[model samples]
Target: MVEYPHPVDIKVHQKSRFLDIAFDDGSHFSLPCEYLRVYSPSAETRGHSPATAKLERGKEMVSITQIEPVGQYAIKIHFDDGHNSGLYDWRYLYNLGKHHDELWQAYLDKLKAVGYQRKDPELAPPDVDV
Candidate 1:
């Protein structure tokens, strides 16, 4: 069985759609919801084979709508887009959290290569001056 260093604390910053996870081993990470959604372990995201995996887009602002415990090893996360099939094992989650920076940067690069923007270009920026 894979062993995970106990999490010293887990803080979900809903406004930022980021989870700050700190392990007792003195390691910590901030995982964005969009990254989690796109990297989901669900077959729908990763597919049966890597070549068959669908490239996800326009999810830079996605959020976790719910998090359900799955036994002692995993958590099933429900995304705002209705995807809830991924059962995130503790080890997987820990790995993702640990490598969030590299993974997220890679994802951004992929999005740029595909000429995809995270948010709609046609939409005007929200008016901040009032």
Candidate 2:
């Protein structure tokens, strides 16, 4: 059996909206909060399978409100947007980090294909639109 690497440290930088995770294999990933929110492994985001996956948009300003450990294998991340589902396991998180560039490019391509213009978080209005 393949031994998946385990995280040695994890830090949430709320100001920068990035989650930095360091694994035992000397690999590290700095994942953006927006990316994590959009790629959440929950039924609401991932659905039942890849064929039913949902594309999330407008999460550029999302931040990590909290991160709760699930046993020794996973962590549940809470976003400022009120989404708290999805348990990110070691293997899954590692894969996400390993393929960040490719996956991110694919996501960008999909958004472009649908003509979804991502708003600049610095210039965009708050989540609550009046």
Q: Give the per-residue lDDT digits (tens) of candidate 1, residues 32-129.
A: 77778999999999899989887889776677788887886678988888889978877788899888789888888888899887773232212211
Q: Relative to the unseen true structure, what is the C-alpha lDDT of residue 83 in candidate 1, on a scale of 0 to 100?
A: 88
| Strongest candidate by TM-score | 2
Model 2 clash count equals 0
- Give the Cα-based TM-score of candidate 2 against the true structure: 0.90
The most accurate candidate by lDDT is 2
In Å, residue 125's CA in model 1 sits off its true spot by 20
Report the lDDT of model 2 for residue 59: 91
| Superposition-based RMSD of candidate 2 using all C-alpha atoms, in angstroms | 5.3
Evaluate model 2: give its lDDT.
Answer: 0.88
Which segments of model 1 are wrong by more than 4 Å?
Answer: 6-8, 120-130
How does each model score on lDDT? 0.77, 0.88
